[model samples]
Target chain A: MSTVLLDGTEQLINGLMYGCFYALIGGGFTLLFGVLRRFNLAYGSTIMAGAYAGLIPVYLFNAPVLVLFVTTIVVSVLVGLLVEFCCFRFLRKGHELAPLMTTIGMLIVIDETIVYLTDAVGLKYPAPFGDESLALGPFLIRPDYLAILVVSVVSFSAIFYLLYRTRFGRAMRAVAERPDAAQILGVSVRHVNVLTFVLTSALAGIIGFFAAVSVGSARPEMAAWLTGKGLVVMVLGGLGSFPGAIVGGLALGVLEFEAVWFLGSSYRDILAFAILFLVLIVRPGGLLGTRTA
Target chain B: MEYYVAIGSIIGIHAMLGLSVYLVAISGQMSFGQQGFFALGAYLAGLSTALWGLHLLPALVLGVVVAAAVGLLVGFPALRVRGLYLAIATFGFGEIVRLAFLNVRYTRRIGDRVVGPNASEGFRHVRYIYDRGITPLEYLGIILLALVVVVILFYFLERSKLGAKLRAVEEDEVAASMIGINVTRVKVFGFTVAAGVAGLAGGLFIHYSSYIDHDMVALPLAIASVTYPIFGGLGSFVGPLLGAVALVGLTESLRTLHGAREFIYGALIILTMLFRPRGIVDEALVLRVKGWLPLRAARRPAPAP
Candidate 1:
């Protein structure tokens, strides 16, 4: 009994640590959805593009970790801007699925371009911190996991500050609430939309760098998988809720770890989608979301 | 000869899938889980013929019925959400079904060989057509027959009163309800029929390939199934058929391009959406074609929705 309790506690801590990553990714997705009322299926692919771009300097010049991080954010911002221009900017006010379908097209293009360049092979990614673990009372925690938790929390706080404590954030929220009214009030909906994309893409870049570090490899296929997980996390928390994304991601991480412990690795993804299905059924607006439509 | 025949069969099967998407799409519910119904139909139909030693027609019927029944069960809970929520919910449903199949490992010994789904290793040796010595041409004919029957059903449905109700719900649910359109019933009915048609497509697909796998019905298939209707035209049932043929034909032609095929395909979809957002077979195109034929009264086309 004591051993089981120890394992459960360890799992809980580890799950919360992993949940930070999902929170970061899901937060980016929710931000985009909140501002535009549309999903950029290419969001993960844009991040993947940034990661791969960062990898080039590492491969050719063996750049330091900071250079790689900087490169990733720069490239991610550019790719995010391009996606907004092609998929969202002009296609706005068209059919409901127009932007979605266009993003999917962009996703395929980005993923396939990466595959073509890299021959669809995974590349080794260096972790910022060395591979070491800290033992904390019957638990072994990796240093990188700690780093991820810190970075994710700080990032989340930064986003909260930007959203709530700034003039731009107010404009963003106004646009999200009512685009026409915001336009009438001279919010420049286009600027808010572009800026929102930039913010989320930068967040995605940071998350991607951390993900590549923890996994110790970068692959093109990660885009679609990340997109799926981000969507699941976004819906599980609430469609357009920010805080909800954090709570939902953390809960999913914990539940996923428990699933892996009780069942097996094979059942991990199943558990995620099963919970999502149930949440959508019982609470259509999500755990922290108010009912809409 | 055999290659073209096989391509034709695939196009027919995809057309069936596209039509299923069209049915659900016209009702205003954007489902990303029709592939779930397809997987169910494929597995169930394959099992009936391979494991139970049933005939092809009966196996296909069993597949359609089971998928349609599950669709009805799914439709109620699914009806609670709208727009992106509905799309994500259906997407979750699709992932659940796919993952479930990934873990399922049901097999039995038939004669001297093992058959049935073997988890991620995939279900193989579903050789009902091969065992019967059916040729590729004959299989293609079978698929075309199935497609024809489905098209006929869609043709009749397009002219029926329920079709109007379905479109009415798509336009505005509140107004539709106020007009006594029974919005819930129309949406659920559309969902059920779409699942059934997807099941039929899967039944034919497994027979042709002589294999079934969870990965085969994953996200790509779901995306392609929906893309066909949207790409071809959403104006009428004929749109998906045309879309399926054109897009699949493009895919087959681009097979020789190696790495460039997918890149070009993606670019083309983007370009098409930019140029013709309503798809290749919108109301304008239909009207223009009608004008070419003699004795047709020219009615002004409805502006693109």
Candidate 2:
């Protein structure tokens, strides 16, 4: 009984740590959706491309962790901007499905390119935190997980500050609330859209690099997998809600870990999807999403 | 000769999948999960023939029925959601079906041969075509016959009242409802028929390949399936068919490109959207082609002054 209790606690802590990682990944998706009211289907692929660009330094010159982060963020932002320009910018507005289709195309292009260039091989990356565990009164936590948690919290707080306390955040909010009204009020919707893409891409790059560090390697399929998980988190957290994303991510982490503890490893993905389906059905608005229309 | 036949049959199967996507798409709902129904049809049809010793026609019918029923079940719940939500819901459903198939281990011994979906190893020895000694040419003929029938049906549907109703709903659900159209019924019916069409394609696919695994029906397949209708244009019934033919031909011809085929597909989608927007075959092109045809009724009569 005592062992089971310890196991449960460990699972809870670990799930939360993983949840933070998911939240970080999901943040970009939700942010884009919140501002644009359109899904960026290429979100995952752009991040994957950014991570691949970052990996170049590691493969060629054994770059430090900071260099990796910087390269990933810069390349990711550039890729994000490219996606916005090519897929989102020129298309006529009100044709909702067009943007989705274009982004899906962009996603395919980026993902296939990564797979081709890497020859589908998983590559190693440097991690800031080594594989060390600290025991705190019968609870054990890994250094990498702790680092992820710290980063997730700090990043989300920064996002909150950006959204609530900054001028740019105010313009973004205004645009999200009503593009026409915001435009009349002096906010350039196009500029906000591009800036939002940049911000989210940088966040994705950071998280992608962190994920590579945690796993010690990045594979071509990681982009799709991360996208899938990020979708689950976004939906669970209530579509475009930032606080909801954080909560949803943590909840998903805890729920998934507990599910694995009770059932098995295979149940992890199944559980996430099942929850997404159910949430969409019973409450399409999600835990934090308000039903639009 | 065999290679051409195989390619023709594969194109037919993909065309069927494209039509299925087209059906849902014409109704204004974007389902990225038609592959779920496709997989269902494949597995169920494969089971009936491989395990129960049924004939091909009945097996295919059974696959269609089961898939349509599941689609109806999905469709009813889908009524509550619209736009992106519905797409995501369907995507989740597709993944669920894939994962379930990954873990499903139902096999039975029949005359010294174990047959069924054996977890991830995949269901093998579908043997209907193999056992009967049906030539690849013969199979291609059967596929073409099926494709022709589906095309004719879609052609009629494009002119049918139900088709108009679907288009109206796609334009605006509230307005459609206000105009006394049963929005729920039309959407649900579209989903059901689309699933049936997808199932038929899947049944054909499984028999041709003689094997299937969860991975084959993954997200990539779903994307490829949707890409057809979008690339083809939504203006005419033949749009998806044209899209499927063109895209599949490109992929097959570029087989030696070593990953560039998919890259091209992605680039084409972006370029098409940027330039064409309404796809390569839009309403205007369809009108122009129809005007050139010798059919007397193809031309619209001028308004009397």
Candidate 3:
């Protein structure tokens, strides 16, 4: 194989791995928005919290990778519930902006809390997969990156199947489509909403754990960068569309990396935003969003 | 004297920032991207004056023009979206602008190179009447006076047909469209006007500080602007102004407290949302306060009888 082909293949694989991470975040974002119809600005912070939560078990007791991951997910679920209780539950039926603004307020609180907890220090987390690179034909991928990709795909697929095939999944879709109708059909709307929030936060937390493992470090400000990208990916994929988010996340990941390679890394964000702007202009409903609205 | 001047200048600039947020929130668009426009305006003004050696007035005007032009470009897509989508799009735009400023070679490397028609070497010596022998207090007073005039004008505009149309569009786009109002055009106009105000504030900020950086136009400032309208009560015309003054004063007071300031700031936002969701200047509260105050005074005499 040619050297250029090998590099391209490697870049593509890397992009896919990163794309999987984004998909997880984007999926969580979409799920929350679908259920509540409110943007949770604190979602990114939850991810960060999850990373720190996972780091605690790993760093303090030198826990195995699986234990760290479980801890992260559990912590994220609690954080999500806390946010919903504090910011959303009371204001659920109020103006849409009420919960939205409250979430933004929560974001600042969470960020400050993290900063205070960490003593304003940046902490590093060791990857369970260790520092090993695996060779696949002409392409070389880190074991951890491959693991993240596989885990994300499986998790997302599981979510899709649950949402579509299970009785609970049917109820969720019913609630998403029409709350009144769902309630009439014996669905506990509030319970479902809370469950959705927990589910989304847990997913974000798992992603955050893997993300910290991938980056090999955790910091107070780790989630700030992810906030905008996750939001953009959610929007570009069509707000509540599960498939749309997956496609959008992958496309964005590939495009961003490609832009970095070709136009210099500095211009990567500009290119990403330009693409987002154009997509918004050309297709306001997103690539797979329902055009009926 | 310089210290006094700096204090006055900061207040004036902050008031301008407050008013910029006011203009957008009044029209029913909660734009947290004003900082982006503000930064653009400041950068344009600073570049034209310091680098291109333009006269201060022309530099200010040019800055406003540049900021408005960029606003128009961004606003076109914004007009098609609203709610969280619009907020997210504008947020993305603001981030892009910040990144571009940080990464763009020319913006960083240009380093006060005089460009355009005002590149004459002796231009720095020229002074406007406003700058000539003006005391800091007097300068501040004059800026406040000018702001008052602008506010009055905006007040009237809010009560005028265009303002009504803008409000109607905001309240219910479908109803506004049914009534034959151009929803898109009105929204774009509201966005442009808001952008222009932000630009004006930015230009003034640069002149006041004599410095410009990408940090000036980031998300924190945007969040501050958004919080102002919410805190002041979005229903009233004076809400943003009051909110801004209160928030700015509180922030200034908290600054001396060090690390706790941020936590306090976050708490303030949450508490305001929880307790006074309609803001401090709700019409019903004003009326109730008025009625209660007069009754209390009258009750003392009645009790004696």
Q: What's the TM for model 2?
A: 0.96
Weakest ten-residue segment in model 2 chain B by summed lDDT: B294-303
Residue-by-residue lDDT tens digits, candidate 1, A87-188: 887773758877777888898888889999999999999977889888998898888888989999899999899999999999999998999999999999
Query: Which residue pairs show collisions in model 3?
Result: B51-B114
* Residue range A29-141, candidate 3, lDDT tens digits: 98888877778889988999988888787778988888888988999999989888878776636465567667878888888888877887878887689787898876778
**Residue lDDT tens for model 2, B178-247:** 9999999999999999999999999998999999999999988898888888889888878888889998
Q: Residue B192 deviation, candidate 3, in Å?
A: 0.7
Could you tell me the TM-score of candidate 3? 0.88
Question: Which stretches of candidate 1 lie above 4 Å from their native place?
Answer: B287-305
Write out the backbone clash pairs for model 2: none
Indicate the DockQ of the complex predicted as candidate 3.
0.45
- Candidate 2 yields a Cα-based lDDT of 0.88
Q: Which tens-of-lDDT digit does each residue in B181-204 have in candidate 1?
A: 888889999999999999999999
Question: Scoring each candidate complex against the real one, what DockQ results?
Answer: 0.69, 0.69, 0.45
